[model samples]
Target: MSEPRWLTDEEQHVWREFSVATRMLQAHLEGQLQHESNMPHTYYEVLVALSEAPEHRLRMSELADARKSSRSRLSHAVSRLEANGWVRRESCPTDKRGAWAVLTAEGFAAIKAAAPGHVEAVRESLFGPLTAEQVVALGEISTAIREGLSPRCAAAAAAAEAESACAGEVPEESFGVA
Candidate 1:
């Protein structure tokens, strides 16, 4: 095998900056949503996905894909939203295993009430400090990152021991190697 290519100082700096910036942004957004909307950022994302779907409904699988989430996790989130009367589940007639997640009128109202503050929070946290050109650059960078980690690349990464699902403080024995 060829020798491993290690990151230079500049590359390491750039990586750290990008990683910390994303984490900080998510933390800020999460705190804002939890405080103002009484929902976590993940739940808000689900509601937004459902609200944008045709007739405010999507197949459970589609919802999971939209959220980039697994079926079991999405099911748990749906259950929570259903309990809050923000969403309802209906079995699909064509596919017994398939179901639809439907946003209710109350859910629509809840989202509408939540949107203004959420948008403002996003603006303050993300767009407020950036120049117009920087905002454009941010969009390009985000899209590139998303495409780079698409399923094809993800599979290759996993086979290479890339540990895509790990967070900080995980044990090497319990989790995969670094």
Candidate 2:
């Protein structure tokens, strides 16, 4: 194998800070959702995706992709949400193995209830410390890094956009970073 390129001192420092920040933010949000919203952050994201989709539904695979989730992981989450009456699965008539994740009325209401606290948590943990200029810069930096790291990400994004269900713009309330 070829020798790996080593990070410079500054690169190393930036990477460490970025890694820690992402992990800490995720942990903070996860704990907040579990404690205050009575749901995991992952489930909340699923509900939000479905709630935003047309007819409050998306194909199972699409949902998994949107959430960066494995098939089995998404399936497990759907099962848990199903038990909570927050989501339901409907088999596709045209494709036997295909299925849809549909948000129930209860799910919509749950998201509605959970959203305020969730957004607040995000703002507090993520945006509260940043100035407006810093926020914009961070968003740009994040997107540039993401696009650089994953060559197929743009293609996947375009596919999601063509489908139009899984890639809708987040409303201003969600901060629209996505």
User: Worst 10-residue stretch by lDDT in candidate 2?
Assistant: 169-178
By TM-score, the best candidate is: 1
Tens digit of per-residue lDDT, candidate 2, span 17-59:
9999999999999999999889999999999999999999998
Best by lDDT: 2
Candidate 1 weakest ten by summed lDDT: 169-178
**Candidate-wise lDDT, in order:** 0.80, 0.83
Pairs of residues at least 3 apart in sequence or in different chains that clash in candidate 1? none
Q: In model 2, what is the error at residue 97, expressed in angstroms?
A: 1.7
List the candidates' TM-scores in order. 0.84, 0.82
TM-score of 1: 0.84
